[model samples]
Target chain A: MYKIKVHVYLKENILDPQGKAVTNALHQLGFNEVQTVRVGKYFQLFTDNVDDIESRIKSMCQKLLVNEVIEDVDFTIENAA
Target chain B: MYKIKVHVYLKENILDPQGKAVTNALHQLGFNEVQTVRVGKYFQLFTDNVDDIESRIKSMCQKLLVNEVIEDVDFTIENAA
Candidate 1:
């Protein structure tokens, strides 16, 4: 089996309200050193070994895992223990 | 400055409905090789240099970034460009 870890985050230009709220909350909680926060999604996928796994994973991201318009995604594939 | 990346995921015993839904959707999309999916949260934090940054981050995670009851979190810190 192969393990795939995917990270999907908002585009640089996109405003992340959730992240902003977290930063503000942290500041109020006395973590004033925190300058900014960007929140995103992470996914771990387990799959059987297949030919062209990279393309398959990319297609999965493009089709359902990521929103291309407002977000960007990257992933790493590794052997599963 | 420092950049911290935090990953928060449901505990192993926890049921992840969203991830299950994604897995089902992928199967419907013909990716039957997919065995399982687990979804989680990712955070990018920018902070000023500070002593004991790792402990500070751990405190933040315990206090606000994560719910220790059902979630587990880990983070890595690095110098910011």
Candidate 2:
């Protein structure tokens, strides 16, 4: 099996209320060092092969993974035994 | 203020139990077409300026925004009036 990673975030000019909330919570918990905070998405995927990983996953991203106008994503691949 | 976006996801080959769970939930909700599913983080940030957006936000990602070892992420930027 293979593994795929996906991340999603909003554009720089966009505002993130959720991120701010989390940052506040984390700070309250004692991690006050988090001066600036933004929240995003994280995922790990398992697949059969890499032959079609990009085309398939990228398509999935556009359709179901991302909000193109206001978000960005970076993906990684690996062989999982 | 300027806005910043951040995303974080697990690297390919990594296993995401949470993603699987969400996929299952979505499937149960009726989106069965989702053959493969992974979940990640998404964030939007507001900043005072862009001059230091990259250095500051990128550093935030490494220190707090991302897991580095098992996740991938992409972010966008825009000017907010």
Candidate 3:
């Protein structure tokens, strides 16, 4: 099987409230060093097909994995077995 | 500021319902190639102090960012300018 790892993050122009909350929490917890915080998504996927995985993953990201309007997705593929 | 990127994922032994749901959806959508799927968290953190960012991040992961029992956390630090 092939292992596909996807990372999805909000675009620079978008606002992330969750990230801001975390940053505020850190500051409240005495970690004043923390400035900005943004949260994202990570996925680990196993696939039977190794051939054309890049294209397949691209399609997956475009279709179901990411919201193309607000988030950007990137991925890496590796041999699982 | 320093940009810190954190990736948190469940250990192999743990079950991920969200990943399973996504996998089932993909199969229903005709992507039967998918075998197993696991969902995780991603974070982008900005910090003013770079001198001790690594240790600070390690502490953040251990204390507030990661559960440490069921999830594993990994991170990278970069100059955010």
Candidate 4:
């Protein structure tokens, strides 16, 4: 078995209204000084052991996980068995 | 300043075409036995010190970071100053 961790986010140049909204919400909730915020996603998966997980993961990001138009994705594979 | 890592991925049970495409690409590249693959994204940001990064981060995930339609997001804040 293998454990994979995938992380996702918007491209830096892109405007993250979602991120900004959250940052504003935070200010409202009490935490100030938060200049900005960026948000993304994550996943943990168990897979049958495979070699070359990194490249494959990256390929996956490019092909499906990310919008490429606005978002980006990166993944790490760990705890292979 | 605070550093945040945001990860994003498709929600479990949601079909991950990107992940599948990547896994297939991996097999083409030589690594086999890879039954499953999932992909996501990551974002790192340096922010002016904020009082509560975790909850705020999580709130961001719920409100904006994730699609809620097909994806999910989680964030970790570290190296705060």
Please give, for residues B1-81, the per-residue lDDT of candidate 2 as tens digits. 555556665675898787787677646654444446667776666555566556656666666667887777677776665
Please name the candidate that would achieve the greatest TM-score relative to the true structure: 1
lDDT of each: 0.92, 0.67, 0.89, 0.69
Instruction: List candidate 1 stretches off by more than 4 Å.
Output: none
Q: How well does chain B match by TM-score in each candidate?
A: 0.91, 0.83, 0.90, 0.81
Regions more than 4 Å wrong, model 4: B6-46, B50-81
Provide the lDDT at B5 for model 2: 58
List model 1 lDDT by residue over B1-81, tens digit each: 888989999998999999999999999998888999999999999987667888888999999999999999988888887
Candidate 1's TM-score reads 0.95
Instruction: Write down the C-alpha DockQ for each prediction.
Output: 0.84, 0.26, 0.80, 0.35
* For model 4 chain B, the run of ten residues with the poorest summed lDDT: B26-35
Residues A1-81 of candidate 3: C-alpha lDDT, one tens digit per residue: 788889999998999999989998888887888888899999999987877778888888888999999999988888888
- lDDT by residue (A10-40, candidate 1, tens digit) is 9989999999999999999999899999999
Q: In model 3, which residue pairs have backbone atoms overlapping below 3 Å? A: none
Pairs with steric clashes in candidate 1: none
- Provide i-RMS per model in Å: 0.9, 5.6, 1.2, 4.3
TM-score of 2: 0.55
- Give me the displacement of residue A6 in model 2, in angstroms: 0.3
Candidate 4 accuracy as lDDT: 0.69
- Count of clashing pairs, candidate 3: 0
> Positional deviation of B81 in candidate 1, in angstroms?
0.2
Which docking class does model 4 fall in?
acceptable
